[model samples]
Target chain A: MEISELKITIVGLGLIGGSFSMALRELKPKKLWAVDINQDVLKMAETQGIIDRGFLKPNIPLKNSDVVIISLYPEQTVNFIKNNLNNFKRGAVITDTTGIKDKILTEINNFIRDDLEFIGGHPMAGKEAMGFEFASAEIFKGANYILTPTDKNKEENIKLIEKIVMGIGCKNLIKISPKKHDEIIAYTSQMPHILALALVNSNHIDGLGLFVGDSFRAITRVANINARLWAELLIKNKDNILGQIKSFEDSLINIKKSVMEMDSDGLRRIFEKGSDMRDILWRL
Target chain B: MEISELKITIVGLGLIGGSFSMALRELKPKKLWAVDINQDVLKMAETQGIIDRGFLKPNIPLKNSDVVIISLYPEQTVNFIKNNLNNFKRGAVITDTTGIKDKILTEINNFIRDDLEFIGGHPMAGKEAMGFEFASAEIFKGANYILTPTDKNKEENIKLIEKIVMGIGCKNLIKISPKKHDEIIAYTSQMPHILALALVNSNHIDGLGLFVGDSFRAITRVANINARLWAELLIKNKDNILGQIKSFEDSLINIKKSVMEMDSDGLRRIFEKGSDMRDILWRL
Candidate 1:
């Protein structure tokens, strides 16, 4: 499918959705549509030229589309897919930019009409800032683009969606088992937010944190209240994120045990292990 | 005092020393002497042109000079200061570019000669690569240059050292007690490396990481290890680093508890507290 000929519907005109729309526009999709719960945001998205059209709700006419891209939070993504499945054109490929995927995959498998297949996507990109104003097309450049397709997705559907991501300037094409994808992301993506949340709150004694230095500023850069979004998602993907958090917690406890006993050798091992790992990551 | 009139001696001639020398040269210091135990590294430093003159071994004439700087690992920093103390000229201002200071400060306070005090210098600048070849005067530009001067340092001595850091490109001059500096850095600087280390190692499991995607790479980039150097310091400051590790551990356990019980309210409270702290940090 040629970039200019493809029609795109971006559900949820928040940061990810708005930004994805901007990236899609660069590929010059035929018609860019925006959907959001907030009518004011949809209007703003249209005025800002983020999309060619805006919808206050998803159930409105969306038939003029080749692909339906869902960018809602983890908890809302599946239900949003269900609500709008009837509106999509026949054989249209549905995908999402949601952080958690296993749950969403299961929902699509169980709830969506058999005719409409939902391929999963998570362009591993974002920034500290939130909302539509901070959205930009270049955010996807040099970033990983994932395509998760179930048994139901036609081979053509997966390739068409993959072309969209490639045309939008992503660096690599990654196709992984849906379960495997969610497990790794839970560790790298969801858990960091959880840990950042923990780091900020742990030191927040009596609200005297105003004097925090650049260290705290750098570490907890993402801890700000996207509370409704992050909180709901954390609950939805609790098992995997909790496991990642536990592994990190165990590492911390081990280091603490070594330090308290003044066991230099033991502590050194941990640092060595940590450093070796960091070094490997740089190469990758 | 103008930079052209100042005499400077930089010991160890590695990344920190070489970079300091290069930057100070631009500020027009009168004469610079570089010393290192490694003859090859000393030759490399001279060829890199970070110093005007160089030494492979310690010499009395250099020790008797008015100013001496030691830029070595934390373990070697105190010994270097103590070794040069008796042979130095009277009233010579000594300083070091060691990462940690509390223990070094206490050791110097009790052991060093009264008239010649060692003021600590910690320029918060770094890179993944090491050695004089990787050193650039530009690294220190705009970084926070901390001067930890104990009561042992005379007012005149403190002013002179501060002038040198300011002469180089450091923009922020922060004065902090050695204990506080150690405690804060334990959390900010030291702990981040540890976290990066653990994160990288955890991701390296099963060689299955071959398919590891972008978010994993982004989060674990800092894990790359300089094992010999980092292990040495992590051991020396085990107690403080442990305290920080424990605090983070407690946070993870608490979040895990909230998740296990499916307590949405508990999760929100935790997320909100972290968000508030993170938001404020981002503002700055």
Candidate 2:
């Protein structure tokens, strides 16, 4: 299909969904359909011309969409697809924007229409603060997007989803199994959030003004978190996060032991190792 | 002493020292004397017009200085003062800029000339990239200047140091006991560095381009650390850092346990608490 003739439907008008809608607008789709449960969000999106049409509930026109992007919270995303699987057009390339993938992919794949396809997608980018108010199309610029497609996924469906992902301005489109994506995310994304939260909660931050510098600000910047969304993400990816925490805790304990023992050489080794590892980013 | 009529001596010529010399230039003292062990650094400062006179070694002219500031690494700061206590002019207010203080303060207070007063000062600001080339007078523009003065310190001497701190554009001058400063710094400064180092060291960061995001970058920005300087600091403030690590690890364990148990409510509570604590910085 020509890019301009594609009918694209984006469900959930939150940050990711709204931003994705704006980005997909650049493709000049024939019909841009937005589905949001919040009436205010739907009204604002429609009034702002963010979509050709907005729905408080799924409607018949959504059934004609050539592509559907579910951008709800992880659990809601699976339930939405399960309930509305038959509403989607036959051979519609369906994808989702959720941080966790294993459960959602499995559940959707279990009951998805055989004619349609469900590809698990995650944009590895987010604002520490949530909601549609802060949404911007630039948020996904140069960000990594992972697509987790199981053996059940059709080749053409995967290709169509990839085209949409590229059209949305994602820098890297990595193809990984859902299980591997979870493990990598647990280490890179989830562990850092846990560390930031723990660092903030462990301190009496009342007098932090007198003591803080750039380092504290940099480390705790993530502490200005979307608490509800993160709590859901953490709970959904419990096992991988737990394992990542264990790996992180072991490293922490080793350094703590060195500091306690006044082993300057040992402590230096750890800092040097960390500096070396972090330098990889600069090299890249 | 009148501000401009006073002769000021600055020892050591690294980042803090170089920046201080440049900042003190605004006072236009009678003679801004610079002493550095490295003759090359002394020559460079004189050529740059950062100082009126350069001294390769402590000289008789240094004895006539009304105010002396020692800016060096923690251990070096203590050693410099111990060796040159007699070199400072009688009744001159002496101060040193070093992160850790209890040891430096006690040693200086133990064997000091009765006429000369020693005050411990820490300008709580720095850049991760170190060197005289990177130093700037603007670094102290809005940074807190902490003065840890013991009972042996004269009130008049503390006031004199405060004037110098203000003249150099420090936004605030806070008086804290040396013991309290170390404890607070362990949580505010040292703990964050430890966490950053741990986070960097804990991961296989080689392929980080594929998994990194803004949050990861924020938390690890401090990972471009001065490894040797930080190693020395971690060792010098060992006891306080250990205590902080223990407190932080307790919070981490609580979080890890909640994630392991899939207790979303408990995890939410922790995130909410952290968000609340972190919000204080924004309010300030």
DockQ of each: 0.41, 0.68
- Against the hidden reference, what TM-scores do the models get? 0.88, 0.96
Candidate 2 local lDDT, residue A51: 88
For model 1, the stretches where C-alpha displacement exceeds 4 angstroms are: A1-8, A23-33, A44-53, A57-66, A84-92, A204-218, B1-6, B27-30, B44-52, B204-219, B282-284
Candidate 2: segments with Cα more than 4 A from true spot: none
**Chain B only, TM-score of each candidate:** 0.92, 0.95
Per-residue lDDT of candidate 1, residues B170-215 (tens digit): 8778888787777777766676566656665555234334345543
Model number with the top DockQ: 2
lDDT score of residue B245 within candidate 2 = 88
Which lDDT tens digits does candidate 2 get at residues B1-284? Answer: 56788898998888999999999998888889888888888888889999987888776656888888888888887777778877888788888888888877887788888988889999987887777888889999988999999988888878888988998899989998898888888888888888877877777533555776677777887787777778888788888888888889899999988878888888888999999888876456
Give the alpha-carbon lDDT of every model. Answer: 0.74, 0.84
